[model samples]
Structure formats: structure tokens, C-alpha cells
Target: MNTDTARAAILAQIRARQGRPAAQHAMEVADVEVDIGRHVRGPQPALGDRADRIARFTAQAQALQTRVARVASAQDVPAAVAAYLHEQALPLNGVAWDTLAAHPWAEAGLTLEYRPPRDEDKLGLTGCFCAVAETGSLVLASSPATPSSTHLLPETHIAIVPASRIVPALEDAYALLRAELGELPRALSTVSGPSRTGDIEQTIVLGAHGPYRVHVVIVDAD
Candidate 1:
């Protein structure tokens, strides 16, 4: 089932448990919709001018051990990604979102499979729906073309984010989603950095659950 259908079913079950009949449940749903339409927002931090958003996001991402790179445009993404992989001595073969299949990846000497990553694949590349400058998180809305596995299954995850898509905070990212999509995607993922765990001897262990490295390529549209 789709996200909206699943959400509706879950809410309906809750309403049923509350002893509300179908009609009353419909009314409650309507009320919730009305509130959602209002797009109420809470207090937000004072993020500086819009131009500084990239800088703030970069700093926060770096603090989380996520390497960041700046590209002039989408056309430069493949080159930048290639350069990063070479610098880190990583393989160039991996899976990528089908939506980016149009890019000149082959020209850049990169071999990216336009599908989900396999066991042998160590890298995954994807695009973000939006990015939170406050926490330096990449917000990904999953679809058939962009599966969640692309961001999780690989040992290394690389994201291509457009600078214009950066928002001040997590709330702003959600607001933008509500404005653009009436309903949420089946899977919405917010990744701040590579996976790590401090369960062993209180020492942080990278790649405990997911990718060990996360490289972000921020494309400046203008």
C-alpha cells in the first residue's frame, strides 16, 4: 500500500479503538486535514542570510564526519564524485538512482549501475529531496526511481544536493514537503552522516550498521 493509504488505515484503526463510528472518524480526519492545511510552525532558530546556508550546512556536516564538495552545476557532479572517490582510493563502480542516469557518468570514468546496490557494490549515489541546514541532514523521499536501499545498503554513500534546496531547519524541510507534496512519500529518510556505534568499549565504530563514509556534492545552481 502507498504511504497515504497505510497512514489512513492506521489512523482509522486508532479512531475505531476510540469507539468513534465511521462518520465521526471521517469528521476527525477532516479536522486533521484542516489543521495540516494551516501549516502551523513553531519557534525557529535565527539562521543568517540565505547565502550563508551552504556554509552553515557544510560546517555541520563536517562536524558529523561527512565530507562535502561544491560543484558549479549538475554537469560537474560526475567529475566531482570521481575526484572524491579517487582521492579516497575507493572503487568507481556502484549503484545510483535511475533519475541520474542521464548524467555523463561514463565520460567521467565512473561506472554507476542505475539500480539498487548489490552485495559486491560498495558505493551508492543519490539525490536529496531537500537538505536541512540546521542539522546538515539530507532529506530523501523515496519512490520507485529512488529506493531507500540506495542510501543504506552500500558501504559508501554519496549524495548530490542542490544548494537551492537547502532549508534553515528540519521544520522548514517538512514545511517545504507539505507545500510540494500533499502526502508524504512511502519512505522519508534524513541522514546526517555515516553510520557509527559506540557500543564497543565506548569507542565509536564506523560502518557498524551502514556506510562508513558519506560524501556530499553540493551543486550551486546559480
Candidate 2:
């Protein structure tokens, strides 16, 4: 059986053993919604003022070795990305999410394939679902247009983050997801920085499993 169907079957069996309804009834569903709506959050760190979250995010991200660039608007993204690739001495050809196909990549002298990354692809560009300022993480929700491989399978991953989508904490990101998406996607990846591991002799090694570099371009105007 498929994963979803198997999961549902297991949960139904557990509910049956617990003497509860095998499936959620309308009243139970409404009650659960009410409980969620009235839930009180636990203590959390003070994230400072709303205006400072972006700065905090930038600082935290930089500490994790994530290169960040700020742009005034979405139209400026192409040039910013191109400059980053040039600075890193990387190629101008890469893969990007289909959602970003309308961007002026050609004008910036960058050639991008609007599809998932291949095993040999060196760079990948994508737009984030949202960003968590508390931990400086990018939330990537997988879909047909925004495949997870774009970020995971490339040597360098560039993400376009809109400033308005930056939240103060992880919990806030989850709340935003529930409110906006209603249902979770098949996969949700929270990437903090470039992949690293300290497995050999406790020496840290970047790109141990995934992208060697993560460059974020934040647009001030969403």
C-alpha cells in the first residue's frame, strides 16, 4: 500500500483499540480545530522588534556561513544572482524552479533550466516558502513546480527570499503554513545553511552531503 493509505490504516487501528471512532467525525474535527485555535504557546526567546528580525536573520545566517544579498525588488534578482555566481567563480548555467521561469535570467547572462537538478548540475535556484529568522532557516515546501532536488542535488543552491515572508521564529513559520496552506505538502525541508559534518577526526567538512554553498537573495519588496 501507499504510504498515506498505510499511515491512515495504522492510525485507524490504534483508534479502534482505544475505543474511539475509527475515523474522525464532523464533531471531532470541529473540536480539534477549536482546540488548535485556542492553544497557548509556550515560552519563547525574545526575537526583538519586528523591524530587526531581518537584520537578526542576516546575522544568524552569516554566522552559519550562508552568503546573503539584499535587493530592492524582484526585478533585481537576476543581476544579484549573476553577481554571486561571478564572485564565486562558478558557471552561469544552472537549474531553477519553474516558478522562477519568468525572471530575466537571459538578460543577466545566466542560462537556467526550469526543472529539477541532475546529478551533474552545479547550481540550482529556487524561491523559499518562507524564512525563519530565529534560526535563519529557509522553509522549502515540495511541489511539482518547486522540487526539493533543486536545493539538495546541486553544488551551489541560491534561494530567493521575499522579506515579507520572513517570520520571527520556527513556530511562527509553522503557524503561517497551517493558516495559508491548510495541509502540508509531501515534503518540507528546513535548511539552515550549507550541509556540513564533523564525522572524520571531528573536523568539520562542508558539502558532506548536499550543497557546498547556500546563497540567499532577499528582496525588500515582495
TM-score of each: 0.83, 0.84
> lDDT of each model, Cα atoms only?
0.91, 0.93
TM-score of 2: 0.84
For candidate 2, write residues 1-222 as lDDT tens digits. Answer: 999999999999999999998899999899989988884677876877756888988998999999999999999999999999999999999999999998999999999999888888999999999998988899999999999999999999999999999899888888888999997889999999999999999999999999999999999996
Clashes of 1: 0
lDDT tens per residue, model 1, 20-61: 763355777699999987878788777887678898999999
List runs of model 1 lying over 4 Å from the truth: 1-39
